[model samples]
Target: MSNDNDIRHGRHCVFLMHVHLVFVTKYRREVFTKEILDDLRPMLASVCRDFEAELVEFDGEDDHVHLLVNYPPKVSVSNLVNSLKGVSSRMIRKKNYPSIRKKLWGGALWSPSYFAGSCGGAPIAVIRQYIEQQQTPH
Candidate 1:
């Protein structure tokens, strides 16, 4: 009935948006490990589904992670980053991963700030194809 409502309930179309999400470890500490990364995937995917987005790919070094996601038109990039930050921090801390909890400095696994951006107009399918091509053969 209102413009705000219209914007909020817009159609869910495949817009092929590319968002770069950077999540820093709490206190800028190096906490990530392969064991922890294995556990984080499903949790992030569930949140993405709720936001009408898809986590296309994800990777991390010790201190931060980069996520490539396809977000729908109605989702706010800020809100999406918050969910990823807040939820991952809470979940990882609860798991008692020592490196994470120790450097977290207050039972937090991630920093509050994150990075997000548009795709810079690159075609999504083409990008995905290129990424796929770079993978090593099993």
Candidate 2:
């Protein structure tokens, strides 16, 4: 394996873990402005750092955000998502309440549910082909 594919070493184990996360706004509201999305990236990075993870990529549409994250074996995905959503929601709302409140009238920024998927470093084309080839049992 090349250096790029080498596993990460923790105190007693070696592993590679990555996740793709999507967070949507409450009621699927289109509440995020360009400024809010820009501000959110750093906040997410900071949250990832707090969990000893790295935020690999961040982008989103007006109502949802997509994140690619690299995390260790010790971290729980659910817990990380909770923290990320909670902290970012609080901070963004605190700083941009006027804009946010207009769309998210309940004062909550994110919906309770979010989308998360594990990534195994496979090429997207390969994954798409594999999925497309799956068939139902007779």
Candidate 3:
């Protein structure tokens, strides 16, 4: 249901790639507070901006965060995730929140693994039907 305007333009291609990402805290500790989540929003947004991507949506519970990012094809998902985790962890640790520090004894804010899924487009069945309807060249 997206319009042409929803597509992004690049020097060599047009794209509309979005990924839903989830990052959990190390050991799934319930360390996040409202104030901490508020601070994290801008930090994550800044990291997205660095890769020429947009963080379309972001939210989290006490132990994890979710981000919907619209990124260009040139950027790899793993790389983006790494930067997001690294920067946010370093910055948050720098803040020295007593509650978070005490819970995260291992020194890493996020767990080593994360979830990434492609989103924001027509269903695969619809696309498949469209492809099947294409006329063949004689």
Candidate 4:
């Protein structure tokens, strides 16, 4: 079945593709506290929306963040990463996450890098299912 809302530009446009992206704090900085995560949550969501991606799932263990995103083929991984890192860094810095500021030192909180892989096929469906089950019951 086709998902019309997912279409971009026009009917002849390509179907949206999905990817799972993982970004880490520089040198694994332990900055993903509950408070910090809360602070960044909405910002990340808005940015992802602007990029035509959904931040379907996200979590971190102080050092790294794992995000499940569904993006169009037109959205490059580098562009998405740049926007997230850039916006988060800017906002977090403005919010005065001292540890992040001290550690990153005008640099980005997320390393200037990321891990991205496709999420599709039957296995991909299984992974998304698992992720759904793992949701924290609101």
Highest-scoring model, TM-score: 3
> What is the alpha-carbon RMSD of candidate 1 to the true structure?
11.9
TM-score of each: 0.75, 0.82, 0.94, 0.74
lDDT for model 1 comes to 0.76
Candidate 3 global Cα RMSD: 2.4
> Which regions of candidate 2 fall more than 4 Å away from where they truly are?
1-6, 122-138
Model 3 residue 115 distance off true place after TM-score fit, in angstroms: 0.4
> Each prediction's Cα lDDT score?
0.76, 0.88, 0.93, 0.76
Model 4 residue 82 CA deviation in Å = 1.0
- Model 4 off-target regions past 4 Å? 1-10, 14-16, 123-138
Question: Model 3: clashing residue pairs?
Answer: none
Q: What is the C-alpha RMSD of each candidate to the true structure, in Å?
A: 11.9, 6.4, 2.4, 10.4
Over all chains combined, what TM-score does candidate 1 have? 0.75
Please, what are the lDDT tens digits per residue for candidate 4 over residues 1-138? 144235445345766566777888888878778888877778888898998777777777788877777777778888998898899888888888766777666556778778999765458678789889885965
TM-score of 2: 0.82
Residue lDDT tens for model 2, 20-127: 999999999988889999999999999999988888889999999999888899999999999999999889988965668887875579999999998877789998
Lowest lDDT 10-mer window, candidate 2? 1-10
Q: Write the per-residue lDDT of candidate 3 for residues 22-107, one digit (tens) a residue.
A: 99999999999999999999999999999998888899999999999999999999999999999999999999998798998866
